[model samples]
Target chain A: MTPERGATAVAPVPSETVTRRESTSRRVTGPRPGTGWRQRLEIVVFVTPALALMATFVLWPVISAARMSFYSWRGFGPMDKFVGWRNYELVLGDDVFTGAVMHNFIIVFASLAVQLPLGLGIALLLNRKIRFRGLLRTIVFVPYVVAEVIAGVVWFQLLQPEYGVIDGLIKAVGLTPPEQGFLGTPDLTLATLFVVLTWKYLGMAVLLFMAGLQSVPDDLYEAAQIDGASWWQVQRRIAIPMLGPTIRTWMFLSMIGSLQLFDMVWVLTHGGPANATTTMATYLINQGTGRGNYGIAGAASVILFVIAFVMALVYQVFVLRRDTKEAR
Target chain B: MSRQKMRTFGGGGPLVYALAAVVVALTLGPVLYGALGGFRSNEQLARDPAGLPDPWVTSNYTNVLSNEAFWRYALNSSVIAVVTTVIAVLAGVMAAYPLARYQFKLREPLFMVFVLGLLFPAAVAIIPLFILVTRNLELGNSWWGVALPQAAFALPITVVILRPFLMALPKELEEAAMIDGASRVGVFWRIALPLSTPGLITVGVLAFVGSWNAYLLPLLLLREDMRTLPLGVADYSTEHSADTAGVLAFTSLAMIPALILFLALQKRIVNGLQGAVKG
Candidate 1:
């Protein structure tokens, strides 16, 4: 048994222990009992459910879908002869796919512009002591925890042109309400979804930022305060720079989440109003499941994986290492 | 100038209070509207859309309770959620504690695989997941179709989290138990498990929230007969689109269980999310 290496080692500390263990697993310590042949097999028993599910549902499906790129199967039927890269060609050939990718860029932009800033800003504000701090923090987080179906219900209520409580409230204070719900229009739909998503995810973001924030010591804040640094100045100079690692993490997560956008959009818009808000996820699902063009859907899935994998690689390779150096 | 600045200050007093009031109002406004929306009659919904009920009808609740489909969906969701949480927590805790305690081979790769599971949005994996459930596994159109996949997906992160909490376990306590001739199982079951109940509860509650409000997985894997609360509500709302009031009522019904879960899990889940972020 490896003696307990302490709790912090179990954390994501980039430990050598992790590497050493993985390297040794493939090599043999000779088949024996408890910690040997029997143990390894039992470990597989412990791991099999998760492994099988991950493989069957996650890995196997992905591999099958990747192969579908060679066929022109419309999802419901037999693969009508391999077209060999034709699906990739078709996807590349199509303007809709290009637009979808471009729109995904919009989602990235929206996250950077709205959710990141808003979440960080709120987190910074709430991190300080003030009366009712608990209440305020909880209120902000409510959006994230609220069910998407309920958020869909709330947004539907708020945006209803005639009966929309929001519209009525706006008119009560006097502004010409739009003819329809913002989601009912094409130009506004994606932006509107962006806002709702930001709202829903802001709580999660703030929670993360708070975690990063707590690690920055009170002594630093006190010293800065004594030096006559304004609140904003301290925040910019101390907090932001101190939070570099966390910001990267939050941004990385937001990107992954943005790419994976589904449930709420599916509930609220169903990628409608002429597909103005079409995300890669929505488009993939639409083709694969909705239209039953399984091959194309499979292709979309592979592309999604490539995109997420590439981003995670960059984060793991460059940014995470730099953050480590900064801390050291 | 000093006097003017002072008026705006007091660690952000009245002004901050005013702003917070706006924040609270904006946050609560829609929920207030939806809750009240279901109360008003259809004519009241259309004519005096923002007004309170004339008869102050509680019949929406009664209507919701009387519907067999509604009760069935609610029951299905609760049963699935409770079962999935218990199983996931037990399995996740066992798996995580060993990984945290052991210096076994392939540990990092296994850990990475679990983290990879977290980072992969189920949407991408969902397509192949559907085919596997329907044809390969032949488990389609059942609660197991949804519950099992949810437990699997949730396990990776949930386990990673509990590992940290378990590693935080005091070595002396376990050593003492071992000195008493306690087997590994005895130590874990009696000591470590009891100590980490907080972590277990956090993971369990989160799993509950995720499964209870789940839509897409159930929608894909299950047929009409197997609809859960979320799927049922979404479908019912769509079918009764012409009945906007009815749609709101249905949405309200769907929202209750989630609302209750959130209220219950808010403190633990928030703290857990913080703990798990770095991991």
Candidate 2:
């Protein structure tokens, strides 16, 4: 082919070569023989199964939830009974729903205030040329991978009112354990769950910050140090700004994740001690499937979905835009 | 500060060591305590909750392991996770290939839909999904009831990770195969699929772990006999609330399989996470 191309070279060969390159680029961008029905057919064949499954399972459910929110159904029956806005009205008016929304806010605020900074600090510590760095990283991140049910069970044992590990240690120090235990006390349940949440998810934020830190040029730190900036100042002035994208990404993820939290809370407290730890997700499940009130559950689902969708969209537009643009 | 910043040694200090030690202890303490506590009898646990077992017992483990319910739960979890991973990966690979290689008008928009799927947590959509699966589709209480929706949820991450990976492969290889008169499907199967193994493993491990540990979907979709490991543990706890030791033993047993998988594929999981987040 090379010899034939050379032998057939003509006066306008440069233009021909340029056109061929464009065609080649198009082929690289997509399947060859562009604008042909056959190529389109191949694309359809490749994509149909995935698109079908996603639409049927993911997309359809969300749409159906929207439709189901206006009707009263027992989750097992037809959606024949229509109650326009009553389900939403009830969900909004329900004290438990209010409490669950408050709990979700508390989690989001606490994650932002506590877990994010704590993770960054640890990432900075681990990013240092420290011994056992790999070991430390592995140990911390192990919990993120461990099943939430197990984390809940593990913490359940620790926070038991009487002879659990935490109480045992406290009693050994001559202090009394709280009367209702950590998980059972309304005063302490949300706080205790927050602590557990921090423990479970902190590793993810730390690892993310660590990845961000790797991209930071070491010479910048050196430059800051030579300018008489302290170690803390170097991090605050340079490293942090450099990690802005990562921090934002983690914050978005953390907020959305906190909103949708289920398994850990379900396993730990079942949104109990007077619904103290109920987040949007646990509330939806407990009310919907647990009580078989599909209509109200669907209403709650729409509310939850709107919250998640709006938060994500807002973050992607207002926060993530800069990071993505810079990448491009 | 009278210190030299040693990049190689991480600028070690006594304070750093102290902080690191505290973090490690805090992080691993509960897990280790729980795992070790499983070896103690209920009596011993009550007597000295803070201490090592005075008389270690293997019977707790033996009893849980030998129980038919335990195996049943474990097997159910395996089936759900494995099935979800396989289907999710297959669907993701097919979808990602075109999204990665093609420059069609709808390409970016289609990819965006999958990306947006990451935001739709199962909690927010469980009601209708439950209705659709159990009532409309009549898959209620079946393994597929859980597995199908999970695969759908798993698709977004799988596609996101695998698309970039497929894009990174050399385009010339496919062209070479095509010049030999190979069809598009032939090139995809022969060249693209084989080259995507690492990406496959990354997506596979992720989907498998996510499915294995998933709580809400299985909780809603599957019944008692179809209960996965996490469900089984939850059920066991409620039923055996009296036996703290037995609950711990059950928890320990449930933790082992996922732990083994995570430990074995720690590198891939961590790196894959970094890749997915960065992407």
Candidate 3:
């Protein structure tokens, strides 16, 4: 086929000759075939399994919960007549939701605070040629693929109130071990969770950033070195600038991940000590799935979804677009 | 002066080395705590959680293996994960083919549709997934419930990873097969599938690891007969006595497949990740 095309090209191949190419271009930049009923049928076949599955499984629940939000009903009883924001009224008025929202930010803020520098430190360390680098890389990537629930379970023991390994370590190191269990105290629970979350996730972040670092052109660093820039200066001006996009991606995942955090908290604290560690995900789950307030849960979800959706939109439109546009 | 000096690699600077050491230790500490410390006796565990088992009893290994539940969890996890991996790869590869090859209308839009799966948290889809599993499909409390949805969810990344490799293949070969009067199915099966080995392996490795380690979907869907490895970890830790050993044993066993998967795909992951960045 290539040879025929090659020969035809030498012989001034007719423009209308390439049937498949013409078809493809017309299909993409359309108005030629007008509307491709055949193509649409094929698409249905290709995408229907996924789309049907998602729509039935995903959108149905979404719509169900949204409808429920307007009513005052637990999952079991007859749907109460629409109260039109009464559920919102309760969510807004509830100290638990407000407190959980604060706790969510605490987790996000604390995680980013710890993960950023720590991730960079690990990445920079690994980037340097070192002994057992392969083994180290394998080890670092371990936690990332492990089930988040197992991570919670493992860390809980380490942080248990009595005879827990982490508590033991704290006393061993002469740190004032709290009288109440680490997770039992509302004040300490969020902080302890923040630390644990950071430890578990920072490995993946470091791996990503290290991959970003490897992409920074060697010549830029060579030029920086020739300019007699110190190590700190080289990192600041060249490495960080080149790594800007990756850092932004990391920040986005961290935000969304933190927003959706339930596996760890559910397994570890279950929003204990007056719901101090409760997050939006946990709160929604408790209401919707646990309490069977399907409607309120749906509304709460729509609220949470809206909040997450807005944040996602803002990040994509504002941070990502602006950065890429400026970079260009 | 430094460019002229080329005397030693600055990459070997002491601070850089030290930083890597500390980070590596911090990252691997928990994994080591489970793997190596599993051999130590209960007395030794309390005495020094930090120490490696010396004069290693290896009894923890024996004790864990003796638990009938341990084997059950292992077999169930493997079957579910293996089945899930097969389905995910099949669907992921099939879906990715049209996006990769056909340049059809809505191609980019369709590809983006797949990518959206990455963003929606399990909560967003859990209710629906559960509804489908339990009420609609009558798959409630079955391993199939955990396996199928997890496969569907994993398809996006698997497809993306495969598509790039497919795009860069020699279209001449595919065309050559077609010209020999081979049908589209024939072309895809005979020509395309065999050539995409590395990409297939990479996606397969990822899918296996993903299904094996999954927790939330299983928690919401599966019950008694469908106890997965992560479920076992949760049950063992929260409900059982002397959780340290059981939890450690379970965690270590779960981690083996992941680590082995990583090792098998290490080169591809490194390459694939870098390719993604450049693109």
Top candidate (TM-score): 2
Backbone clash pairs for candidate 1 read: A75-A294
Model 1 chain A: lowest-lDDT 10 consecutive positions: A1-10
Top candidate on DockQ is 2
lDDT scores in order = 0.72, 0.83, 0.70
Predictions in order: chain A TM-score:
0.83, 0.88, 0.84
Per-residue C-alpha lDDT of model 2 across residues A33-101, encoded as one tens digit per residue = 555677778779988878888899988988988888899888664679999999999999999998998
lDDT of 2 by residue, B100-175 (tens): 7776788889898898989888787788888788877999888888988999999998998898678667788888
Best by lDDT: 2
What is the two-chain DockQ of model 1? 0.34
Runs in model 3 with CA error above 4 Å? A1-44, A71-83, A322-328, B1-8, B47-55, B175-185
Model 2 chain B — which ten-residue stretch has the worst lDDT?
Answer: B1-10
DockQ of 3: 0.34
lDDT of 3 by residue, B91-183 (tens): 777777667666566887888777666566666556546666887789887877777777777777777677766765667787777568775
Question: In candidate 1, residue A278 scores what lDDT?
Answer: 75
Steric clashes per prediction = 1, 3, 4
Q: Put down candidate 3 lDDT per residue, A212-309, tens digits, no spaces.
A: 87766565556566767766666665666666677787887798788778888888889987888888778877887688766556666777777667
